[model samples]
Target: MQYKLPVSVLVVIYTLDFEVLLLERADHPGSWQSVTGSQDEGESLRETAVREVFEETGLDANHYGLVDWQVQNIYEIYAKWQHRYAPGTRHNTEHVFGLELPCVLPVQLSPREHLSYKWLPWQEAAGLVFSPSNREAILQLPAREKARG
Candidate 1:
């Protein structure tokens, strides 16, 4: 089996009105997170975000306004999921990005990766994610949106 990389991307999919799309992990049961995935060997971080969003949800990331937030979260990998990475890989560096859609769109979840999906107001979605980095990224959305406006 190909062990996963220690680098990943977190793509927060949302609309201009502040609704965020979250996905529940199939492997972790109740763990909900934004569209995320590990980086492939030769891909750029933005590529990872685009690919992950498409893989986890059905959205074509580039078709919308996909912005790299210029933020990185360096955190310890959760014990339960550490085996997916190389041995001794205790930490992961996650790059954050945001995909601003026109509005809520239909989502197609990959059954193996996600159990289900939901679109919630940014605040509620921030409260629902399992990862601290994921939650923090979601929580920052409102301020970022305000700054962009």
Candidate 2:
């Protein structure tokens, strides 16, 4: 089996009105997060974001307003999930991106990965996410897109 790379992307998908999308993990029921996945060899960060968003939520990030947040977070891999990475891999560097939509929309979740999806107010979404970085990113969404208006 191929071990995952240490680099990954965390995409905060939100609507113009700040309804953020969160998905419940199939592996960890009730634990929710935004779109995320590791970078494949030969893929740029934007490419990773687009691929992951589509794979996780059936959304073509390219068709919407996708933007790099120009920020990243480095955090230790959870003990429960560290096995997916190479032995001795302890942390991951997550590049941040934002995908904007007109409003909350239906999502097609991958049953093997995610169990359910929901669009919540940014603040509520932030509180509901299991990852600190994902939560913080959600909390910052409104400010990050303030000028987009």
Give TM per candidate.
0.97, 0.96
Off by over 4 Å in 1: none
Model 1, span 1-149: residue lDDT tens: 89999999999999989899999889888999999999999999999998999888888998999999999999999888888999999999999999999999999999999999999999899899988988999899989989998
Highest TM-score scorer: 1
Pairs in steric clash, model 2: none
What digit string (tens of lDDT, one per residue) describes model 2 on residues 1-149?
A: 89999999999999988999999999999999999999998999999999999999898998999999989999999998888999999999999999999988899999999999988999899989989999899988777777665
Q: Total clashing residue pairs per candidate?
A: 0, 0
- State the number of backbone clashes in model 1: 0
lDDT of each: 0.92, 0.93
